[model samples]
Target: MSTTTREAAGRCPRCGAAVHGDGRFVVWCAACDWNVDPAPPDEDRGRPARVRRALARRHGEHLLAETTDGGAPGPRRDPAALAAYAIALLVHGVTVVLAVGGTWFLVTGWGRPLMAVGLFLLALAWTLRPRPHRPPEDGTPILARADAPELYALIDEVAGVVGTRGADLVVVDAGVNASVTTCGVRGRRLLTLGLPLWEILTPQQRIALLGHEFGHYSNGDARHGRVLATAYRSLTTWRYYFAPAPDPSLLDLLVNLLSLPPRAVVHGVLALLDQLTLRATRRAEYLADSAAARAGSTEAAVGLMDRLLVADSAMTTLRREGNAAQVVRRGTEAGDRADGLWERLVADTESIPEGEYERQRRVGALRGHSVDSTHPPTHLRRARLLSATPVPAAVAMTGGRARAIAAELAATRRTVARHIVRHGFPG
Candidate 1:
């Protein structure tokens, strides 16, 4: 009779244990240590209530409520929008001027068709520009199963508040920074994290970092970035095309000579336009940091900023060391050969650092060597993050939900680091 009763109660699919009814669609099985369901449960019907009960068991109802309610306003895009608008106007004005001026000169017959073809090609390039690819499979899968579920849950919760799609998650083996990318038209969004970044940040700090990245997604920055990049490329193409080619024809020569003044004027206008665009990009970074603060605690955001600076410093040190090693190796190989002028010069340089202490001194000097860098200095980024104000409660309440998801990402770095140490790099 007992066996019959046990069989009547559905067993957990995973553990094969008998289950008892939980009033909701779920049945709890103590023996199997799992919940079993005959059918998919409706999330809207009882999930929230069940979740509330579960949270209450762990954190108490008050703490749970506080966590659910506590949020800061996300960063505002007003400055970015205004800057973008200004750039658009500048671009439009320049384009109009170029079109009109080019048309006027097109009376030379050869110039007219060439200019038109050039403009068409530029437009095509903008429209068909390729996007950056997803990080390769050889990259790290930073987040493990245990961490990923929690992270996804947090993302779902936050996405509800923001009324937007949660970021798509990916982990790259590259030890570096994190960035969010977008794909698809309206509903699809992709977010990627670097394994090195995951390894370095604590849970709260990770949450803060993710908040900033998602803020960019929520603000539609990906779309805006794409537009800006495409437009910039298109403009460059147009500028090149309309530029005068070497001409033997007298009429072409005359037109080219006359066009020089207008072209110079256009160049200045474009420079102003470029400045505006760059200013907007800088402002966007500030806004994203503010968004991070709003989504998580200001303290968490600040911590993340600090960690990022530390990581960047570490990377810089590594790169310098690698460069020094290469230089020394090259110098040694050249000395062994003793064949050419270049080799002799390198051998002589290597001879200058004869002892360990002298080599160390040389390496130390090389540390100060300045290489042209693409991004702004880390100090500037840190200063900006520090100076930024905390996001408003109202904005945080809705915008900051994604912060919790980042908290779940804390374990990812450890898993990735372990794998990396054990397996070496994924090829």
Candidate 2:
């Protein structure tokens, strides 16, 4: 250690080294990268305020067009986007009917059998479809209420604020993301929270994360979630099923030749729907971000997102540090052993000077904004939040309650860490 290494009043829990902070929220140790800290509510100018302010001042006018809260006539009813999926399904049904009835047309010898054969090939593709891909699963240990009552209670408290009654299951995972999804035809709702995300933010930010997720439920995004997921998967199935020419067998060769036209048609339809959904999805993200800001404070909601980016980047360092095969086999127990990885990640991020940190955040925002993905740019989302009215979201879960939630999620986090280290972070 350098002779200049001075001890501070507070020590890093992760590294057992003297840590420093601006006396609130943001905390880190220079010796190790345990930069995670609970954020203070109502204030977070932190060390980067000047840089953020300068950037804001530079882009002040553009902020107005970003719109205030509740103002964006978001694609509440994105007819064009929604219609593409509906029409695609209709076309699929028609093709199914044609495939079945086209054989009779062939018997009449009045029509070419190739089209009928193509239709039949399309139908066969549906049968050969792979199982629907479930929403991203962390494969971590599931925590029953009995195992973590304090945590479940905190969840219920947050749930009340977010306006969802509760979830069927709570999955503890490794990344810095949380999501709500439906599990089965019965529409069982599942809420999964990533501990790395939780570990970095304050109590308020935690609520913001949960609020953002449940916002999906309140905004009817959950309903749309299931439908679109099915649509995407079904689209994928046909794409995969009819994708390749059959093997050289006579029967395979004939079917392969016939499937081509139908395959082309489905490909064209899939491309159209994907483009439409991207727009709808971007709108949905803004709406959800809006809901989260309203449910938690804008600061917390936005901070959660900002810090989440850091956590996400930090998680990648573990790729070379963990045994994927062992984690896949041992689950949470394996994650428990790699507990310090999060600390290491945090330390690395924290060691960077404020200027560099801000630079990186800005560069990341700029570079990421151009991606051909469904979600909107992080900078745009932040801009919208900055322009919108700030609401102080009421949260009953705080202080001791918050700590308990953290403690309860510990075991689940360990297992999730294994899953992440084993399989890697989800995109």
Candidate 3:
């Protein structure tokens, strides 16, 4: 059940304006946003800001236009997708050649120094081998059906409604986002639900989130396909191994010079692959959003997108709460802050005004902010969701069942909150 809502608590320290929140949540001025998001924005590591924004704006504008025109492309045999597969196969061919050549060399030069070359080639092949997705071994406990029957049942219901198999495993964590991915050699589905995100969302929004993630499975996301995915991983490994050494010594400089050509070649292939799959990947996301709407209704899906737009702020709020906990506990026996941690987060997020959401929408448009580099811009997603025909939710979240799921998650909520309060979020 959700916490009770309270009225204005105090004045904003920065703006001398009304600060509205329950005491458990941070009191912040909506006018100045003081204490609303204290953490600095995360650094962008993937692409230059200018380039990302440009691409996002272009894609977003084009997609919005297409949505308006009712010409959104459906699943089709994209030449770009086929080209990406071809490139991936070509990349895998290199590994095959190395493996075969190494075997031949070892056989022909059994007792010769050429056997050393064979070992080297074999090692290179191993390094470049296609890697399948694997379940993360991080210490977070996995929630099997036996452990959380209600939660799993809910997920299964949503998956069924969304036309995909239920996740084989579920992980609860401190993040402000959720995702579903195929993991393990057998391609078992895994769903990672961020408690922070879950805490702030309504039950229907949660259903929408799950539907959107599982939608990737039935939607044929180009990025998730085995061939291209493994090829991307292999290329990344190649990049890492061939990357130039920092502050190079003389010998390191010689090695770097030797590796320069292969590094350049690997880089070119990676870029080409990215370009080839870019459109298909973006289209897949929209299709997933459609699935989300189909499962949870357009209103809930739109609400989910709004939640995503403010996710960074949500993270920032959690970080600040964690820091506050640390400060309050200083010089005292370290104690549990987990109990009210979620209540505070829920309050803080709920305290945010509609104006703040509008501000975030504008900021997203100007900066092309998205859930990630791969997703389309949040404003565009919201616009598209709103533009689509509204439908009734296929999966219902009854209060009794919602409470059962919460009860199932009770221990996990505390554990995740305790971790966040102690160490802040992992990068």
TM-score of 1: 0.45
Order the candidates by TM-score, highest first.
3, 2, 1
In model 1, the Cα lDDT at residue 292 comes to 65
Better of 2 and 3 by lDDT: 3
N/CA/C clash count, model 3 = 0
Residue-wise C-alpha lDDT for candidate 1, range 171-235, written one tens digit per residue: 54545577766544442455566655654565556666767776665654422455454445545
Pairs that collide in candidate 1 are 71-396, 72-395, 72-396, 73-392, 73-395, 73-396, 140-173, 295-400
lDDT of 2 by residue, 1-427 (tens): 1112233368878779876544312455556555442331233343233333333434433433544534644335557656865765665565456555655554553456566665565566456333333444534566777888877676676667766766767776665677877776767677877666666666787777877777666654522555556655666666676865645688788877888898888777665665555455555666677767766788888886677555534554455345443544655555444676566555554553453344334544444433324455566677787777777776645678877876776666656665556666554
How far off is residue 231 in model 3, in Å? 1.1
For lDDT, the strongest prediction is: 3
Record all residue pairs in model 2 with backbone atoms less than 3 Å apart, i.e. clashing.
33-346, 33-347, 34-347, 332-415
For candidate 1, give the lDDT of residue 81.
53
List RMSD in Å for every model shown: 25.0, 11.2, 4.8
Model 1, backbone clash pairs (residues 3+ apart or across chains), number: 8
Expressed as tens digits, the lDDT of each residue in 322-411 for candidate 3 is 776676755352244667788877887887667567666666554464335567877888888887668889998999999999989888
Give me the runs in candidate 3 sitting further than 4 Å from their true place: 1-57, 71-73, 249-251, 328-335, 369-373
